[model samples]
Target: MNEKQFDKIKNGKGFIAALDQSGGSTPKALAAYGVQEDAYANEDEMFNLVHDMRTRIITSPAFDSKYILGAILFEQTMDREIEGMYTADYLAEKKEIVPFLKVDKGLAEEANGVQLMKPITNLDELLKRANERHIFGTKMRSVIKEPNEEGIRAIVDQQFEVGKQIIAAGLIPIIEPEVDINSSGKKECEQLLKKEILKHLDQLQDTENVMLKLTIPTEANVYKELIDHPRVVRVVALSGGYSTVIANEKLKENEGLIASFSRALSQDLNANQTDEEFNDTLEKAVQSIYEASI
Candidate 1:
């Protein structure tokens, strides 16, 4: 990763807006906004709704580097033209929001007590395109339904393995090992997850350059070591299913973790608002999340 590009984001607003919902999640999001299931009955309609939402986000007068340093975008949204401007370029040049690409192929069938993200077979091509487009970074994710030792270990190993490739490809990778909030033994699992992450970081001689996006642990500030690690550039938290208000409360307590929220950031936004109402609503959401980062 280019140090200048990385510093531009890390030293500014301490949060990243996760707008990288896959095709499967987009319709549900649209439905939640009262677009109705029928309105996005097919792929094209669903994509159109997402495009409009993304455009509104970038064009909002409230959009600035102060509230959001970066945004993680799905492949379609990354390539789509935002009012004839390349979506990523418009965000970087016009709004100062660094664009990060989502490279994981969602989840694969469960194995060894966990769900793993499918490998990106076209990663080299994807990275080339990202570099060509001047995008800043990349993100990939895996889910932990339960904290089985074997499962968590496999996940940590896989993330760092891919993370190394992303770094060599000239983009930072936000490796996410999202633990389910409702899982039993969540607290114990959190500690185990932390240990495994450290184990992996130790293996990487150049980890000080790595980035992490983990679920908020049951205990506050439990990731102090990882956050303070010389190899880790930034540590961010995922809201998972929490509401924005609750997510902010948890985020405020963690010294190293900044918000990289998806649903919590967009859940309260309805499609019925006027442009002024929408921007005001967005400003409040962005500001609350940004304050927690501070």
Candidate 2:
């Protein structure tokens, strides 16, 4: 691990930018940025357009390390170049922001009330490339839709299993087991998730630290223990479909959890905006999220 990068993520005051929208989520992200579906004819064109959007955001003056600690990038974006350098290098060397790669293929079909991560057939190869490209760590996700203890346990187990692999490969893993915000048993689900996560975290060795990206708890500071765990590097909150205002409001209620927002961060931005307007919008989002995080 890059010790400087590790220290930054461990103690940074700002939030991570989730620019890792992939496959199905890309179109929705583009539409929110004012790019219509008709603008791209094929998958390649679609990826190119989204990459351009990411490039704009990454290069914006408002997207600086003073208010942004790190960024989570899609696999396609990781392989691409920006400002004549690999994207990860640009983030770490030029912008002073740590870079993490999204490593999961996506989720499996919901079973036992949860959607576990699909198998990552090429994770080793991906990790090799990530290290070569100066990536600091990786993020993978699974989802829980109910308070089924069995399902939540399975999700945490799988996350830890893969997270161990990431650790062995010399990268910190951001384990994300997201609970659906609209679940009828949302609070119960959060409780079950907390219990399961604690069980796994207790089993880790002293050297095996991992990050967590969780849904904002239904109650304030419910994850304070996770935030303070010796085996936890940092605990961040996902926007989970909430608007920026709502997400930040809930985030402030939790003293330690910071933001790793995708939709909420970009909600106010538009592809049609001038550079100055875009920067101003991004600056507001960055500053607000930074304040809530700190």
Q: For each candidate, C-alpha RMSD in Å? A: 1.5, 0.7
TM-score of each model, in listed order = 0.96, 0.99
| Candidate 2 C-alpha lDDT tens digits along 38-76 | 999999999999999999999999999998999999999
- Give per-residue CA lDDT, model 1, range 247-287, as digits (tens): 99989988868999988888877889898888898889899
TM-score of 2: 0.99
**CA lDDT of every candidate:** 0.85, 0.95
CA shift of 269, model 2, Å:
1.0
Give candidate 2 misplaced runs (Cα > 4 Å). none
Model 1 backbone overlap count: 2
> Which residue runs of candidate 1 sit more than 4 Å off their true CA positions?
none
For residue 167, what is the lDDT in candidate 2?
97
Candidate 1, overall lDDT?
0.85
